[model samples]
Target: MTPLLEIALLNIRPGQTEEFEAAFAQAQPLISGMKGYVRHELRRCLEDDHRYALLVWWETLEDHTVGFRGSAQYQEWRALLHHFYDPFPTVEHFVGVLP
Candidate 1:
């Protein structure tokens, strides 16, 4: 089966980019250690410093939706990172259609 890509568009609270990055550093290990996790990245938007994109690759959709979200680590992940958002991000999953 094709790998799943999870994307989250994050808009952090104004002036909290540095703190959020630091918190995310602490939170990274939580997601990285979960079952079915392949890899992930966090990128800041060029035009908007408060905006970010979080991309995570998993072996399967359930690996993220069920396995990770249901794990204890998710709670920690939320605690570390969730408050930074001005509004919660929208998360979506995708699969390669070509190449």
Candidate 2:
């Protein structure tokens, strides 16, 4: 498996969690079908209505940089979810350091 991965931390606007989730549910299928995408998991913080994390695993960094960014679906993804964020989201890439 490729080592590159991404995690996006998001803070949704207050009272917007449900709207955000509904939008994301619509986009999930498109995201999963993209080139080089291995998997993604969306999690909401149990105690917070405005917090979420998206753990996205890909085959390579290029899967996100080249494939996802260049695809038309990205525009849809952005359109569907961007406005729900409070200060936009932060994306961090990582490599597994221990078993």
Candidate 3:
């Protein structure tokens, strides 16, 4: 099956960028070790310091929506990182089209 790319646009609370990043650093390992995880990256928006983009590649969609989201580790991930967002982020999946 084709790998899936998960994208999330995060808008962090004002004055919370540093703390949010610190929390994300700690939470990264949780997603990385999941069953179908291929790779991932987190990027900060240059124009908006409080905005971030998270990209994660997975072997299959279920590996993330079911496997990871269903695991206890996700709870830990959420606890560590969720509070920093001003408005919750939207997560979407993509499949390679051209190459």
Residue 44 Cα positional deviation in candidate 3, in Å, after optimal superposition: 0.4
lDDT per residue for candidate 1 within 1-99, as digits (tens), equals 667899999999998999999999999999999899999999999999999999999999999999999999999999999999979999999999999
Local error of candidate 3 at residue 34 (angstroms): 0.4
Whole-model Cα lDDT of every candidate shown, in order: 0.94, 0.89, 0.95
Residue lDDT tens for model 2, 23-68: 9999998789988888899999898858999999998888898899
lDDT, residue 59, model 3:
99
TM-score, one value per model: 0.97, 0.93, 0.97
Error of 2 at 1 (Å): 2.7
lDDT of 3 at 64: 96
Which residue ranges in model 3 land beyond 4 Å of their true spot?
A: none
For model 3 the local lDDT of residue 42 reads 96
How many backbone clashes are present in model 2? 0
Better of 2 and 3 by TM-score: 3
Cα distance off (Å), candidate 3, residue 32: 0.7
TM-score between candidate 1 and the true structure:
0.97
RMSD values, in order shown: 0.7, 1.1, 0.8
